[model samples]
Target chain A: MNLFSIFGLGGNSHGVRKTESSGKEEHFTDTYILALVHKLRTPLNAARWALDSVIHGDDTGKEAQREILNEGYNKIISAINTVNEILKAAEMDSKDGVDLKKEKLNLCDIVDDILKTLGYLIKRNEIKLEYGDKCNPTIIFGDREMLDLSLTNLFDNAFRYSPKGNVFVALTREGGMAKLVIKDDGIGIDKEDMSHLYEKFHRGKNAKVVDPNENGVGLYATKKIIEMHGGKIEVDSELNKGTTVEVDLPID
Target chain B: MADFTNKRILLVEDDNFLSELLSKKLMESKANVMRAADGEEAITMVKANPKFDLILLDLMLPKVGGFEVMEAINADPKIAGTPIIILSNLGQKNDVEKGVSLGAKKFLVKAILSLDEIVDAVAEIIK
Candidate 1:
């Protein structure tokens, strides 16, 4: 009946679910659930404070009140997006795999849309984004929504990790494949953390030190989505130096 | 209601909406408010103007972090004595202890406190 029961975190005997029989896996599940709660609280807190200001503050005019309301609305939308991502990741983890609606899509358009969504944070963090494309309208055959989610995950990491640094995103063609490169001169991964980069709920030590609220599900879901599309993902990183991620997909 | 006429306060928070709301509230109390969007910027501003009446710091930041910023300030004799009130989402016992040990006069969790309460805390501190 409670929220934790819905996630099988409650103490109810029937709520208990079986895992891979590894203590590490169970630990990961617990950590992931906690992180999800923390992540959800962030946007909700913002929305709450916005509403609080509108209700209590007296000096604000109608214009300012409207702006605060809009901010609260956006924060609620952000919380919904986080929940949707959790659902998408869970669906992808299912044995049947995620259902994808295949279509002809342009990688450039997808990249542009994600960038537009992140433009505010990019500017606030003082990150300079350099987007280059050797092949215009690099087309690929895939599910637009799934690819959008995957690429957005990658792009989000690139921008989020890089503060006051440059993010260079390049797109090119390599024979029968389309290559997308996202490089950031931000806090990079350590050697030990590199091996488990794609593991569910595994966050790099340095990454956690920088942003502690990260849930560590983005890369795991991203890899799954990419693999389902018959694509490949590669990452190269050096601690404090930077990170570069290369994703290759079959060209249309 | 507390008045903070000409009292200078530096608010170190990254969230645009939250920062704007807090800043507006502090300004309504007549406190002169300076804002920092990241830990690095917070440190820079603190060093540049060490005469601030109080500081409101957020732990999770972009380039640097809140605790590190406090450390940097504590290292410098000129800014070491500046009063700081940590306003963060991290409210674990260890986090609060660390903030207190780092010379934070008060540790306030953002989620639990209302704007009026935060302003009141600030006013009480600097009064």
Candidate 2:
């Protein structure tokens, strides 16, 4: 017999109902996010352990060594892509979120460091890599983790989509901008797909044909990483030909 | 030299993916590997089977962490002083220090140590 009865026991004041609905939605979203994280991480964590053992020599080079190496590396790459997707999704929802500590480091050295993690994958795929650097050994200010991840995502995409072609990585500097170019000759993207290419969860038409389980987060994350580093990402592709991605980051 | 061929190892980790991959790797090394999905299982397995020679423990585990497993291993009279190495993705400076203090002989980050390195570390520690 209170204000509730007087208000017909249903309608609420100005903000209460909206806030409650938003809170419930947020709760469900968080739970879904946590579950996604677990699902994405399981295979990757396992692959890392396997790689650790294989590289550490705990497991001898037996008959299954090469096979395990191949499978583990692929799974790890897939897991990494999944995690990146989750991060990108989260970052999209939160406007001011996840501040990063930027540092000055040589791009060549960063690329070299990422190469180690990717050695097994490159070997398994048999993709010939042609790499060169025209940029000076100058330092740039940016988040090292994001830089590494950006490079990884680029290289992983090249490897994943182009299993039979040569993948190329070239670095150069022009007008105070450090440019990184990655090109792969495999199943290229269509002009229509190019518009939404960097959109989260938007796998290109060719991507679906090349790999059914493609989550379409690599390029999106790559774009985000570039933008976060005060940069821009561009792409050039033609179906049944190749795809070239160019990212330019300012040297601060 | 002690015949370490076929010696059992207690591997504790919370990451299910890494656990399965590592178990397969250890099995390939001919070291009859026993895997625990978490710290609780690790302790239970170690207590139930006292024949394990080395313990490869991951630092981050659900329910019980690597330090707790290390303490449990140290407290048990049956398996005291057994070699334990901390393998983890949590390779921060403080995490390494804590693992060392908890009785792990060595700590290696996953990114730094490849699968081959892990296998090598196990062989060296057990041997």
Candidate 3:
């Protein structure tokens, strides 16, 4: 899906150009609508980031502060759960239901956003995650919502499988592309497991043993979204050593 | 050396929640903050005041949009050079690039940005 067309950009994405058709006004409305969708989702993630930081023991000095933070943490979970339920219900109506409104975004910022949202989960699992560098930059053109879901599921998989070891994430800008490598020293996937790992509802033989609640569908979802953005996911693993899933996306 | 303690900033926004949050954060950084709730007021403030070090703007507003405000302010030669940072939830790629071409120093998406991150960006911009 060329979002430049949807937003009436006439093909050029990095710079502005007038639309060939007489629908300039219509394009403006569509741009505003796309922006409106983003605005609707801003606070949900922002609140989660702020609350997760506090709940993950940024400060536990005062009783009231702890109480309020805990309440906020729980509330964000309920809100997220409700939103997920709604999205899942929507998904049932259409296989590819989630709207993919493409846009150019910083790869690092998206990763950091998801990490903040999962701050509490990471803290609970005792996973040491790293990805930001002041000097390095990684920017990509893709749908923020779809990419958010893809990266969330990817990080979720990495965190759940690896309980003791660090789950390191790094964004490498090289060869005119950005590579997000999520490597974990968890129960590594068997070679056979890699065969159907990206198939819907297919999980490794040992995945259930580590986390019974594993949906077995997250990787497939992540792969689909990544593919939609003209990216590829490759998994390298040893049965006992670790697993690394590298997502390479073209940079704009 | 851009010390925010003595620098004035114009924060143009309509959302009270975000306005208060960002305003409070910028103030804590010791920046003297002025505010405009709409693009019309922002234009006036940008034109009337020449001492502002930076202008933080939001797109959606009650009276006018941020782009118009940008155009109105940038049209004036005296304040045209003042860097304007777009702190918005308008996360579309086109929106960001458009803002940049219109003379935005940086386009920071609010949804994926923490207040601390934004404050850091402001500090960097001031420097």
Distance from true location, Cα of A37 in model 3, Å: 28
- Point to the candidate with the largest TM-score: 1
**lDDT of model 2 at position A105:** 82
Give the higher-lDDT candidate: 1 or 3.
Answer: 1
DockQ of each: 0.41, 0.11, 0.08
Deviating ranges (above 4 Å) for candidate 3: A1-99, B1-127
DockQ-based class of model 3: incorrect
Best by lDDT: 1
* Candidate 1 residue-wise lDDT, B1-127, digit = tens: 7799988999999877789889988888888999998898999999898578999999988678999999999999998978999998777788899999999999998878889999888977898
Evaluate model 2 with DockQ and give the value.
0.11
Kindly report which residue stretches of model 2 are placed more than 4 angstroms away from their true locations once superposed: A1-81, A133-135, B1-127
Docking class of 2: incorrect
* Cα lDDT of model 3 by residue, A1-252, tens digit: 343333323443222344667488457546444533553455454464446445442354587555545554564664565456335323522434556678889987888888888886688778877655552667788888778878888888788778777888888877988999999998889988887676544567666555432342356667767877889999898887789999999898
Candidate 1: lDDT of A13? 30
Q: Report the Cα lDDT for residue A95, model 3.
A: 35
What is the full ranking by lDDT, best candidate first? 1, 3, 2
Task: Judge candidate 1 at residue B94 and give its lDDT.
Answer: 83
Q: Highest DockQ among the candidates is held by which one? A: 1
Better of 1 and 2 by lDDT: 1
User: In model 1, which residue pairs have backbone atoms overlapping below 3 Å?
Assistant: none
